[model samples]
Target: MVFPRPRPPERSDPASCGTHRACRSCWRDPGALPQGHGRIRRYAAGADLAAQGEPPADILTLIEGWLLLSALLSDGRRQILHIVVPGDVVVPLLVGSAGFGIQAATDATVCAMPVAAATTSPTAHPAGLHVLMKAMSRNAAMAYEHLTAVGRRTARERVALLLVELYYRCRRAAIPDHAVQIPLTQGVLADALGLTAVHVNRTLKTLRADGLVAYEGGMLRILDPDRLAAAACFDVEAAGAWLGPCPPGPPTPVPPTAPMPPGASR
Candidate 1:
């Protein structure tokens, strides 16, 4: 598909321009491209950014809005793997047949860099390579965490943990607020959490009644972040370690490697 000509990068804080902290850090490097290198494309909600089973071509970074990485069952059921927010890089890693696909969850913009360029551009700069490697590592860590949540967490815990995770991820993006804008419907949440929409609705209601969170008009207010975290049993230290410098602790046990899923490797 033909994309529009790229737009100029936002003039404000470079890191603040997108969602991925690693992408932002790389942008801040002295050797970073002055105008940035990539084609920025706008996608309508529900558009396919990358299709499963298609040959990989470019690495995409969300510049605005949300995307969903998902897989389709033979019976046509959709299993959402993860949500992609701004600055999240979408890389293609699986060969032969794609295991997942990327769909825009909302009207969005993404920067598309040719895989060849994305790989070779950072070779001359140690800082750029470091940032890129960290980003990839963090992405893998998060994928493992998602797998764990899907495989083991209870319905309530899964929903709560997702909220907590999003809250902190937004905070890491420098969005300073107690409220988070969740551009997902209950159905989407259900798909991501491996629960039915009714179950998700019930869980959310319970959270609201407990005064742990408030969801209204597409915004989620964390009324009691501490209580919410407690409910989800969120590991704050481990989760936030990938974001920035923190006191060292025992390393987070690496989740066993599995076949590459669409969003898991890039």
Candidate 2:
């Protein structure tokens, strides 16, 4: 199967958000946000939403587009630690998992809120706190698995795992027909996989040769998803936990002042 070229990132518009309701998971409990909390924000491609070493702020939920959370080595080399896609939280774990900053890989939008406001607002809802804790625990587990990929997997294995991960993420977002619409560059893939661009290109070529992945322009299609996942040593447990319950009223953005859980990592 050949994947079509991904369209350009969606332009953000603040007036476009319909209502200020909490996310489905949060709203489900009826006790999530205080009666009058939450805010939405839009970001352009290459925008830095959260920088490393900065004080904790509101948690960010990715309403659209791709995002990268990376950290700098002592030598200044950047390592792409995690990729945040639609429905994923940018800073869900806590304030001190690692020294990583979050940025948009493409045009994106998010709902951000202050950490303190989230926990302290007199209107804090118990149901909302329950959902938030569950989300953070889930994210923590994923970070551990991704760390394993970088530390123990071969370069090819790492790339395969990453693509499989992306495929699942897109699917959970209910993106049509299992399509991956992110404009992931070779250099970005290299950073995420902890390899050089040359190595990334070579591995992609190999996947193409095996007919496991089809690439055109910058888009990629997993022709034989089973084979691809197998090659990557994909973990069903990690993938399963990565996706939360479906959202209500489609995907939407939240306010930037959302609370920051102490355990939120990236």
Candidate 3:
């Protein structure tokens, strides 16, 4: 089925959310103060919302479906940095970021406005500012989390943590029957986690065997949320915090690793 541009949600519509009541999501009560209204744009799945080197001068806020925020390396490698859903403010040229692009992971609609107008609108609503602030904070934390996962986590741990993250992110969208929708392919997972598709596949298999999580038919089921979090060392609160993750604590050996042998041959 094709997704169409959403109608402006009136006060009675569920989509018409209050500033704080919207739970940090962006689009709601279109044309209302704080959530400036704009022209609606629709994108098909796999369509580039923002091309690798060309970013639109206007801001595009999601009205529905998922988006893949990515960056392309000079060597032609792509890194899937974030997967965003409805009520998220997204633009290709994120502040201080170059080489980043956004693609539609599923059919989507967005409310678009020019940068200058969006910033200087008479209805400079706090909700709009909240959306911008929270999105930046959360996205930055996510990038840092991904960096840690890629650098220090095992393949299985990385996959588990990623799944756990998605589980929580989709909770707001509803996890019907313990399952969350995941439209991404293993290749996307591989790019996100800095692993090969084979590695992601094998790690997912291990997660299934461990009864932590399992994926099938575009859904990921968390069979054991507690156990899965333990395996991933996931800090759920930090992951979902609206004010952004807490300042990280100093590290210590948990399972404890031995230091490199003294005077070992280089």
Model 1, position 111, has a per-residue lDDT of: 70
lDDT of each: 0.64, 0.64, 0.60
Ranking by TM-score: 2, 1, 3
Cα-based TM-score, every candidate: 0.76, 0.78, 0.72
lDDT string for model 1 (1-266, tens) is 32222233233232222344445543566554323545667777877777776666667777778889888777677889878876666766735645777888888877776665556654334554565577678778888887888899988889888877775665454333222365777778878888987777778778878998654434455676567878988777767765442222224311111112112112
Q: Identify the superior model by TM-score, candidate 1 or candidate 3.
A: 1
Q: Number of the top candidate by TM-score?
A: 2
Off by over 4 Å in 3: 1-36, 91-97, 175-179, 215-220, 242-266
Report lDDT (Cα) of residue 136, candidate 2: 77
Give one digit per residue, the lDDT tens place, for model 2 in 1-266: 11122232234334322254425432454446544345667677887776676566667767767789888666667888788877776544455643677778887777665565556677666665665677677778778878899899998899888877776666566434334465677778888888988888788778878888764443465676568889998855546756543223223321111111122222
Poorest 10 consecutive residues by lDDT, candidate 2: 254-263
Error of 1 at 185 (Å): 0.5
lDDT (tens digit, per residue) of candidate 3 on 1-266: 11222232222222322333333345343443344345566677777666555534656667677788787777678888877866566643535434667778788776665654545567666556555566567667777888999899998888878776665555555423332456667788888899988777777767767776544333455676557767988777756574233222225211111121222121
